[model samples]
Target: MTSARDIVPISARLLERLEALGTPRDRVLAHAGLAATTALSTEQFFAFWRAVEEVSPRRDLGLVVGAEASERGYSVASAAALHAADLAGALHTLARYKRLTCPEVVELEVARGEAHVRFHWVLATSEVPRLLVDSTFASFTSLARRGTAGAVAPLRIELARAAGDAALLRERLGCPVAFGAPVDRITFAERALAARFVTADAEAFSRVVPGLEAELVGRSRTRSLRDEVRLVIARKMSSGARPSVDQVARGMHVSARTLQRRLGEERTSYQEQLDAVRRTSARRLLANTDLDPIDIAFLLGFEEPNSFVRAFRGWERTTPTRWRARVARG
Candidate 1:
């Protein structure tokens, strides 16, 4: 039997569709040995997918979900159908509709003569990062096959340090995969933009594209600003000192006002994100490291021991010394 750790959060829509296929929720949960109330961690989520592979070897659950979405009046066509002016337009379409079948954000950006696409996920419901990554790669490949064959060149994937299954990723992406990266990015050839869509379906897509775009925009705006802020702060903190909003704004090439406005849209502030990072880091350090309080404070960018003490109290409702001691004892 699969352990509880192997289950990942799945969308209710996807689950319902699966149920329609005679895949009962209890059976799925039983395969993972996870309770309905449990949220699967990333590791467990991947394991659950592996377990699924064992039980149903030939079926591609991700594709099944995509097909279900297409059946439900959602467009699952390639972006090449739009007669996209360039690869960028195609990417925009892909990013816009990627979530109709998958909940993760697939980011596309052009920098230094290359197109980079990254998959960012919250995993609030699903824990299978590999499944997410592979599904995204498959979607891109399907888009390429239908829209513009040979449009997608070899790509590079940037993944979180904790991500697993490098061998599977390499084989599936047909590209290099790098771990411990700040963001998950897939780099493709710039020349792929010249390829045209093989069979354009503009009229069919037109019926549903607007709604998809609107839904994507709403979700993009609502996603966690804290996570983005945490990433920025973590990068800066790793390199040197922790950055203020103004500094981070400059790094993001946006004005401080713009940064504030964007964060406000997501109902978060730079300072609050910083505090969360500090608190999370503090707990991790206290539990995992033997660093003294003064050292820990400095490492966390606290200039004074008293300030660290105050922050620790706010975060843990106890002193760092006491927290560390309790963890050690436990």
Candidate 2:
């Protein structure tokens, strides 16, 4: 139902939930008439939800899955929101990261004493499934409650879908529900934006923001030669070894000569790419984590502490420890 170029990554959690609930993944895939793949496309995602509706007995499955999501470990995207200063910051982070990782857009607007949150799907040609709408709103309400200590509630909910059982949604969400609206939205008192998240952690948010920024840049285009090589080098580093050109080429399914030629065309080479990544990553680790230089050295695939120190000194014109201290002083 999708081209190889379309790598949509939505609702794997829902798929996993369905599998856990005795609906076999193979059966679901078979029902959707989709091929086994690492990720789903937009069409496949809708099909997956339809499959869930057909197989699962629970009529309100979306709310159940979405409401339970935040209680577990926070996703990288959600982790950003959880560590935000307040409800407004969290919503902003959520919207920013969602746009980075998916075609879905979540926006926040405050005017006339109401803070309005809305969702728009770039790829949706048909009506978004009711299950998904329910799940998304439930997830938002649940996230708000968890972050704000249940201090805020939605004033009203507006769905773009054709009219449904408004009373049922209102009862579950504890808010007035209206259907056939211009956009799928939730309204809250504008003052609710200032409610502090009990879970907020400034340091954690700072640490995650860099990675999210990198993702935001990377997601805007297809992976370049440098990015692909970086991926290989990172994987090799994780295994506690430096990656070689031949190995990197192998990882990328290209011959060494071909990889070199391509890099030349791009005006960069593998070693330069590796050095840039290590410098950036070393700083991030030093600034964010409690890992010692020796540990960070190994994590970055340096053979020994001396090697990492020499490299860091070359990059910063100072020792890693002093650089970290100076950064801390600031």
Which is the leading candidate under TM-score? 2
Ten contiguous residues minimizing lDDT sum, candidate 2: 2-11
lDDT of 2: 0.75
Instruction: Please state the error at residue 295 of candidate 1 in Å.
Output: 18
RMSD per candidate (Å) reads 8.7, 20.6
TM of each candidate vs. truth: 0.54, 0.63
Per-residue C-alpha lDDT of model 2 across residues 101-217, encoded as one tens digit per residue: 445667676789999897655444345667878988988888888899889889999875556667778877878987655446899999999999998999989988998899787
Q: What are the lDDT figures for the candidates, one per model?
A: 0.60, 0.75
Model 1, residue pairs in steric clash: 5-44, 6-44, 9-125, 9-126, 147-197
| lDDT value, residue 222 of candidate 2 | 55
